[model samples]
Target: MTRTRSTWSLDSMPDQSGRTVVITGANSGLGAVTARELSARGAAVVLACRDMSKGEQVTSSLPGAEVVRLDLASLESVREAADEIRGRHERIDLLVNNAGLMMTPRGVTQDGFELQVGTNHLGHFALTGLLLDRLLVTPGSRVVTVTSLAHRWGGGVLDFDNLQAERGYDSMGAYGRSKLTNLLFTHELQRRLAEARAQTIAVAAHPGLSRTSLARYLPLPVRPFIAAGTWVTGQSAAKGALPTLRAATDPTAVGSAFYGPSGPGETRGRPVAVGSSSGSRDPEAMRRLWEISEELTGVRPRFVPASAG
Candidate 1:
């Protein structure tokens, strides 16, 4: 019998009882909404944030929810959080790489990597590698990484030589590069999972033009224009959280597929399977980025190729 594609929504999510989910940036915006909804559905949710006070506040309001201190910009903090998570749970049902920085003023992580790439890509890369074993041992586990539509501006070139933007820095350019790396990492991870015949699936999602705190760093001159644009073209944080929730819970979602808004230019609407830029699908680039991430994070995945197995 042929299966029909059903319209997906938060109401369509399967019961998440007995599942454990870890979400970064759960203190506010899209991540917060995702955590609230998941926890409402009977899942045990971990609110991973850099600010303990904010994390505790959010965690206290939700049932079966707890807080963990995770500063993605610092590798040391990432390791400590991973060890704590491992000690608490033997298996993780879902991991949402949801925390990120937007076009902020140029800065560097504690590890000396570009702020955007460090927090958005490399940090998640290391965290996933550290938790991979638990994911592999659990049935029907998933890794959902949040990317962005700005990735189109990446132009398919990731200048590894100047990844830190030492020569020059353009806030938007750096942001775009980091978002593009997210897709590259997602694709590469899916490939490795397929090769290893692992049960854990890797997928990506974009929030489109959501009204979130992520835009707090917009230049003052552009603030009015952004405000108008968002007012007219953007969706609420709850709606923006749809694509991510769908990627995390949709039974039909497949590894390597990207989810985003279904409206014109993917600006706003219900979540749906969307197309990514051709450059985002370049296999060689994905592989190279993976190598660089592993080297930078020093966290190697425990995957064994199916042939080797």
Candidate 2:
């Protein structure tokens, strides 16, 4: 039987004494909660944050925690952070791409992409490629990415013409595109990993509308509805992190297993294995997205060594 949410607890998690975990956007919110829960299980937790001071302060409170500066909005920062990780660790057991921005004012990334797309999707994409070798070095390693339910709104349609929102800014539209990309990216990466028979698994997860700082971007008019939804079914950040935690560490998790809350409306249950939108599973779109990622990021995920596969 699969492990249900009720079966999982920080205390019941597997002993991770020798394992290492890296969580992005670990300064606060769901990422921080996941870090704490994993650290409780004895994993050497690395908190990658945009703010050094915040990362340091939060990490100091957790056992076996380290802070690393990583601003995912900028490609330069992503490269630097990845290099630093390579220099620091000989092997990486798990990577949780949990950092994200929901909606933001019109802005362009250092790489000249829209801020939401560049940060939420592209940053994680580049980071995953950079760390593929380290993750593939060990068996049972996994890469878990945090997406959002907002992905459903886009129906997997990518407006490439306005990738940077050069036309106009629609915060929700930009956010939706980024999340849809996350799901597609996860599926595509998993397909490639399977083709190569790699040991590393790639999975996608979502918090299912939990009350996170991610909503700081929405317009004031919609805040009440979002808040009411949160009040009705929103779980705590720790609870919200269940799907991601499961994706990252659960033994039964396989490539392409998208996890999310399994309660009524999928908004407030403990983490449970779930399915992504059919639109996200489009192989053609997935392949195209992968190709675009390679071109935009200027890095391809190197294949796992045959000996390790």
Candidate 3:
């Protein structure tokens, strides 16, 4: 029952009733759209956002929706958010690592890692690890991380030595590396879940070139061109949200499967099962990134032990 057709839409997604979903960055853009859609289908959606006011704005229309403050750049905030969510919900059916930063000026997170990787990869990494126990115990739970086509940027491989960009910094390059880490993390997590024989699965998806406010951090000289390009080729935030929604709810979606727009260059259109760059498929790279993430975040997922013979 894999959704192979090019016409797959939100309407085709299975009913999500009785499930509890936690989505980071649900204040706006693709995150907001995803929160709305899943809530419509009867999910008790918790909107994890850095900005409470903005997050609150989106919750009024949806019954049973709650907002939790989550600042992905700060590990303390991430931990607090996870604790609050766990305190409120006994079971988390889905965890959408949807918050991210695009090409932005050189900076570091509260924990001092490079900004993009910190917020986009490390922050989500810690959050997932902290909240994993709930998901591990919940039957058929999933962790769906939203990655990007930019993952293939700047050669599509992670610069292990310069992951924090201490040697140098290129805005776009750092963003790409963080995204590459996202895919690598997803694959490695899936592998671990399989090894543990846990029911929780990890999957990845990308919105393609959706028109979101993520590009606000790009350089001034590049803003107009990027804006024009998005205007001409980008899909709405709701449309961009489709790939993530599909990955989150598609019953046929399995661990390590990726979803993205099926259009030319994967820029825009209906979402379908898509392949990641060969680099993203490398087992060594995934393992290394996972180890680094665990060390940096000081959090390791605790899954149920594999059955004994």
Candidate 4:
């Protein structure tokens, strides 16, 4: 199969008929745009959100769209939502781990983990693990996790000892760590999937600097500065969603591949396969993080080890 690299956009998305896509945080921002377009393409889309009211609002506008309450901050909520999804759908063609918390006020989740890392990384880790069976059974299924440009900051370190940021905290630092973990998880997962010879693949994408509510947590003093930067570098939520949509649907996309904007600094443009920090690709860090995540989430993936395979 000859795979030609070309400029990819939303228009390039193929028809998604008979496919079921579950998108976390599908109520607004990039998630909403992704859901709307996928639904328009004839896919049965599930909006997994923390707020049913907001999810309902988004669902009302899109045909074949439904809401499932999923609070990523609470492992209990993730378990319940996964159970509901498994009960309803025999196979899941796509799972977009798009829900996340940006730089927010210092806080901890019900699970006693730092809010950002808990919601962005651990939550998605557990959800994917719980739903692995369904995905593996569905031929060509893919898991597209949403990361960020912020991942480039903070030296791409996992900081396991301070994983919860209890010793000290910097809002952006915590968020950066979480995003970095997203990439690490993607790499490790793809490795495991390949080892198991599963039909499912794990990929990742980033929205670049999109104008969305995810930035609402920025300090008031820096709001104007962020607004100006966004005005110069940011793209609309619809455009910001292209990379994710591409990662989810592009036939040429491969396991462990990352999609992001094609512009300078990858801030805004059409979607293209991009590179991540070398640290994100470190095998040792990836393995350790995977082990810690399994311990924290209590949802271990059923995959043959590389050596065993």
Q: Which candidate number maximizes TM-score?
A: 3
Worst 10 residues of 1 by lDDT: 1-10
Q: What is the C-alpha lDDT of each candidate?
A: 0.89, 0.85, 0.93, 0.91
How should the candidates be ordered by lDDT, best one leading?
3, 4, 1, 2
lDDT score of model 2? Answer: 0.85
How many clashes in candidate 4? 0
Model 4 CA deviation exceeding 4 Å by range: 1-6, 304-309
The CA root-mean-square deviation of candidate 4, after full C-alpha superposition on the true structure, stands at 3.1
TM-score, every prediction = 0.95, 0.94, 0.97, 0.95
Clashing pairs in 2: none
Q: Name model 2 segments beyond 4 Å from true.
A: 1-12, 306-309
| Candidate 2 minimal-lDDT segment of 10 residues | 1-10
Residue 35, candidate 3: how far off, in angstroms? 0.1
Candidate 3 local lDDT, 130-227, one digit each (tens): 99888987889999999999999977988898999998899999999999999999999999999999888999999988999999999999899999
Candidate 4 per-residue lDDT over residues 1-309, each given as its tens digit: 122354776678899999999999999999999999999999999999998998999999888688999999999999999999999998899999999999999998889989999999999999999988878878889999999989878777677788889888899999999999999999999999998888889999998889999888998999889978997888999999999999999998899999888887788888888889888899998999999999999999896432333
The segments of candidate 3 whose C-alpha lies over 4 angstroms from its true place after superposition are 1-5, 305-309
| Candidate 3 worst ten-residue window by lDDT | 300-309
